[model samples]
Target: MRSKRIVILTEGHTNPITAKTAWAVLRYRGGDVVALFDTTQAGKTAGELMNVGGDIPIIGSLDEVAEPDALLIGIAPMGGKLPTEWKSIIVSAIERGMTIISGLHDFLSNDKDLVAAAEQHGVELVDIRKNNERDVSNRLDLREDCLRIHTVGHDCSIGKMVTSVELTNELKRQGQDAKFVATGQTGIMIEGDGCPVDCVVSDFVNGSIEKQILANQHHDILVIEGQASLAHPRYSAVTAGLLHGCLPHGMILVFEAGRKTVSGMPHIPLTPLPKLIQAYENLAALHMPSKVIGLAMNGRLLTPEQAEDERKRVQDETGLVVCDVFRDGSEPLAAAVMNLRAEIFGTPVAS
Candidate 1:
């Protein structure tokens, strides 16, 4: 994939977090962001709104923007229905020769009008979450030949995917053959591969993960992107399926540092890090043995001093490596993963 110049369409959406598609592209692939199309947030910059990417202009519509390689619809609305208003914009982008990249479960490619428009204009529509409803027939045979790490989180959108992507990038920097297995729509869009576990039926959820891991058997380290929280009542089934399917040898528990309660389920308070990791490890034990190497703390909301203090506190309490995957990078976590490889497989990270 060559460097893509893209504009994100978060039109009619408000919250930045639920704007999952936009946030992932901005946080992980900020360099590609040429502009943001959000009528409500028009005229502002992504820096002012999201506070990460620096001053990417926010436009009122696709008409206001120039040519872009892609137009990304990054909103994952509940029920996954494409808004009627966005439909015209999709057609307009296609007519202008920009490929449409959407992460919605309601695949834009399936829309007859959108399809015709793209074909007429010689553009493409890339739908990440489409065709995930098929059954994965492979038997559940968890592999142990390579080093595997699953990024579990305290809640949905708690930086699990970010941890996996960042760790994979960090390991590759050290010249290791690390493969990232994306497990959700955002991860799929980022990697251009992997499954959306939530879109699969409960019966095939584990199979979905198994298929991804088995395909990457040649890699030295398989950093699988995890989804949801074991503590989240609503989506824990998906989480459990991922754990059983991948059967990771070690774990990196992801969390937003200093969070008081789990997102969405505010009634259920955040679990203590040690207990949470214990629960995750116990679940992982049901399939194959695993241990948590460290914490991938999302310290974006914390002050630098507060983040350092919290990182020190977490390490002191848990006796495991803790790193701000964004700020601190994944060096400590990568080193811990290598150490785990030696402990479990009696080998270094492929030398």
Candidate 2:
């Protein structure tokens, strides 16, 4: 039978017993072990791991251990003291889908992004600071922890727009006060290197748009949208910005269906006038909201006809002012923001 791969890490010599004990448990379970010894302690710590069956595959550095199945990082006082390079090491693990068991103090201070990324992938975060002193076995079952996420949308989808409107109307039908956020061409995607793509560009534009939205900050829920390609390079930038900005408090990722392949998945096309508005409404609901009221629309679609429909729908459903970019005669996006009630900011398209 093939053995499972398990990785163990210790801060310094004080926790050699803890390190050896943790390693022994895994080895007893028929698992292969790779241990990373933090030798930051004058050289005494490095000598200890070598002392006890010491020839264990000692990783001189965190970078040395690129990939591991499960990582047991001991947050010793000495071990917790780290250089910046350690940040990348943990991020790389999260990217590769590793189960990381870390203490609360270790997680909150050192690897915050790693913790978020891990939670994003549904990894369990164990706070061992207080529980480490207790029997690991007895405390494993008590996983009562508070984790909350404030997700915000910076893109749009067709169905999402309609859904936002529908949701708003439904809320009003229930006699609840509602608020929403809507803007034109407010989506972006920024690359790891700061380049722009469809979703990325949309996200970038929306970052500023979000700031503008925050100025008003009157909505209970917010959603944004994009067209054709959902995983367009731009999507990454926008997603990162929204996650970092922590606005709107929810998110909805929208892509066109039957239009193009994004990240190897079929997306719904965001063309036509009406569905574009619907997409805007739908993307509005992707994040958690305040007051838990209704929904709003945000995206770069909405033609003149779509804008008219959206405005009418906004009036009927939300009973609040609604607007679109299509009637503005701006760069044609299958919809113009021109209308008697709405304002346009760019050059008019020659019909």
lDDT (tens digit, per residue) of candidate 2 on 1-351? 121454555544324334433432332332355554454532342335433334345554545554566655543232234335555655555666666554323343345776688778766543333211111111122111111112122233333333333333343343433322222111110000111112223324434434434433343323332222222343444444433333332232222222233332346322433343344334434543321122233323445566566556744654433333212311121111122102222333432
Question: Could you give me the TM-score of model 2 versus the true structure?
Answer: 0.26
lDDT for model 2 comes to 0.36
* Number of the top-ranking candidate, with lDDT as the measure: 1
lDDT of each: 0.83, 0.36
TM-score of 1: 0.89
Question: What TM-score goes with each of the models?
Answer: 0.89, 0.26
Name the lDDT value of residue 155 in candidate 1.
87
